[model samples]
Target chain A: MPHPPVHSPTILCTVDVVLLTLTADGLQVALLVRDRAPHAGALALPGGFVRPTEDSGTRDAAARMLREKTGLHSPYLEQLATFSGPDRDPRGWSVSVVYYALVPPMAPDDGAPAAVEWHPVDRLPPLPFDHAEIVRQALARVRSKSQYSSLPVHLCGERFTLPQLKLVYEAVLGERVNQVSFRRRMDELGMLEPMVGETVGGAHRPAQVWRVKEAFRGELSLSERVLAGRD
Target chain B: MPHPPVHSPTILCTVDVVLLTLTADGLQVALLVRDRAPHAGALALPGGFVRPTEDSGTRDAAARMLREKTGLHSPYLEQLATFSGPDRDPRGWSVSVVYYALVPPMAPDDGAPAAVEWHPVDRLPPLPFDHAEIVRQALARVRSKSQYSSLPVHLCGERFTLPQLKLVYEAVLGERVNQVSFRRRMDELGMLEPMVGETVGGAHRPAQVWRVKEAFRGELSLSERVLAGRD
Candidate 1:
């Protein structure tokens, strides 16, 4: 059989990032106003076209876009999925290698710039292209991973109490996790390191401040059992 | 801050599949010999460049390539990762969206074509390009996911007994899983449905034959607890 003529057209390639954080309101994602056509001035995920001259790979492109656009360095950024199609982009057929980032809560007084907007993930407004679906998948990945891994800890500060960490898990999972079961699972995961002599004020006792172990900062420590939730 | 000039060069995008199956020799991956220049005649993952006019998306491209190249319809095909870089491929800066497919054991008499070679995953030949690393990542993903999901069931046939399914899990995991624990975990995952009036030969008694539920054919049912392994 004769091979079909190779049709390798100029496929538009780009990378988009879903920056997520824990805020007082709840789980929120950072959005930026597009400066170029196709969706100029509309809110969208922070992204840009892949530059072969500069980026070594797609993850490098995602990290560079996150730093340049948000002015925030994420400790946990993962490739969520690659979205592609003919109708997704107006200029031509395109592919967007998407990533989701997690950061600790920003200082309340240090308000974000006008271009960067933090919107609740569940209540995002209409976004351009297939970004809405992208955010939905990112959120689902974060939530599902939070169940069996130490993923939500990225949303906590370098040092945090167990109660604070539990709150972060609840925020990410959107469900109340059983206290005892959470502690047991955390022990099994072995992801936390106690900050020696560090204690924080608590309602009943001085709580020990803990941080994620150095080894598990970039890679998540998975649990053998899922976190039990309060029904 | 000055805006950087956009340099969107043509990125060579393609899709490769790591078709894996269970044989007496262990886990093996399907590979094809390269036919064109730039490592022509070398064994490599079955792949091709994206066709914008034909493929609606990258996944569509992957399905199309699998059908045309392997002559096998994969029931479980999932995107593993997107490998990219300037140095990996000799042609130019490229991106390869990879997917891993699982199949059951084929009859010994029905030998694969000379073009299609099934190499033991652990002991692979020097594959062209970054095909080796792609296979490594695909294998790691399949093994890791097998711990808490019904992913290994895809390596079993349409009708399987509990004992037969356990062996498949052991093969994919490369570890001896406890019989009692394996059965309990499978029950908790709830992916299998009993084929009424069907029984298979067993060591002690006629064992009930089962098949994966229709709902889980495309998706895996995850177990909250990991499959226990004996020391």
Candidate 2:
């Protein structure tokens, strides 16, 4: 007779976050040190188990994980991708629903998780598991999203200068951009509006501050014209 | 005493597919009839367990599962999302990684260990597990991707007419498109070129056939102008 299966079937679910924030240096990501049994003592994306609740869905689970891991509630959170491989975790076969979150940079509390730290995206340390690969994919999606959508605004404060916005894109895409072309594109998209009372500090030519159009909030709609030839 | 903390805990991992194809009626999806074990007899996206492989990564595993289940090869596949909840799989704690795939409208032999059939997206049957919800999310992503990318081309044959191409978009998006606007957008994107030796069969007019542009072959690149809203 054939041997019966050994273990009781179980579903292993967890949430992982790609928390992106804009800093003076450039775009940065928050990473946490794993303190528990699986992958302990390694730098990884902040995440945790999904809790059972009446109103909690996948998005809610992601939000909960973000808050628990980073102590910051981002205004924008979207599902990035899911990662599951038989050998992804040595402990067992676990599947993780990954999310990409955008929030303004903030200081972590003193009592926060001991291993958590903000690392500039370009100079990231070795991440645990497939996290480094996850981050890379998330970054590519973010860069692609920022180009056609108003997502770049999420990386900056409510009030920001054009130069600041340009810098965010440059950092995320890892390249230099032409200011004239970038401004022209922004104007055509109607994504930005000149702020009434703001200007860049400490510059011979004070750059005008602009805010993302409030009416254009939420996810940007993909337009036919934009799809045609606009990047 | 608690069983001395059992070592080498086992977790279940499964692969789910969001198989999309373009047909005359519209975009359709392939679902399989669950025949054995959990969710038996219910219609579900075809899925199976990951096998042990030394060189297989997550993508490779997904591709293998897809090929074995659907008899399709080299289809456009991407990680959609992961569904891992304690109660998601009644058999036990199961973790499933969902992948979205785009295949042209050609019937392939069902190689899965289950009864499989294609159903128009709008008339999908009740699905097993939380698969209906996963399909909905995947469809939404496909629609979004189709708007800005040449992704819909994947739903067509190696060569096709402009009308056939337009119909693919109409079916996937569930909306009628203006002929002039659609053609203009296609031309502007450099997605296709008129074929010299072919003509579409029709009662009223002999329309010219078109092939996907040579330059637009392989994975399409997002244009900076399109990204920056210069159209």
lDDT of 1 by residue, A11-90 (tens): 88899999999998999999998998777999999999989999999999999898788877545989888888888978
Model 1 misplacement above 4 A: A1-7, A108-113, A202-204, B1-7, B108-114, B202-204
Give DockQ: model 1.
0.39
Q: For every candidate structure, what is the RMSD over all alpha carbons to the true structure, in angstroms?
A: 4.4, 6.2
User: Per-residue lDDT tens digits of candidate 2, residues A62-94?
Assistant: 887766666665468888877765567664445
CAPRI quality band, candidate 1:
acceptable
Q: TM-scores of the models, in the given order?
A: 0.92, 0.73
Against the true structure, candidate 1 reaches a TM-score of 0.92
lDDT of 1 at A13: 89
lDDT of 1: 0.86
Model 1, position B193, has a per-residue lDDT of: 97
lDDT of 2 by residue, B94-131 (tens): 55678888877775443433345789888988887888
Model 1 error, position B195 (Å): 2.7
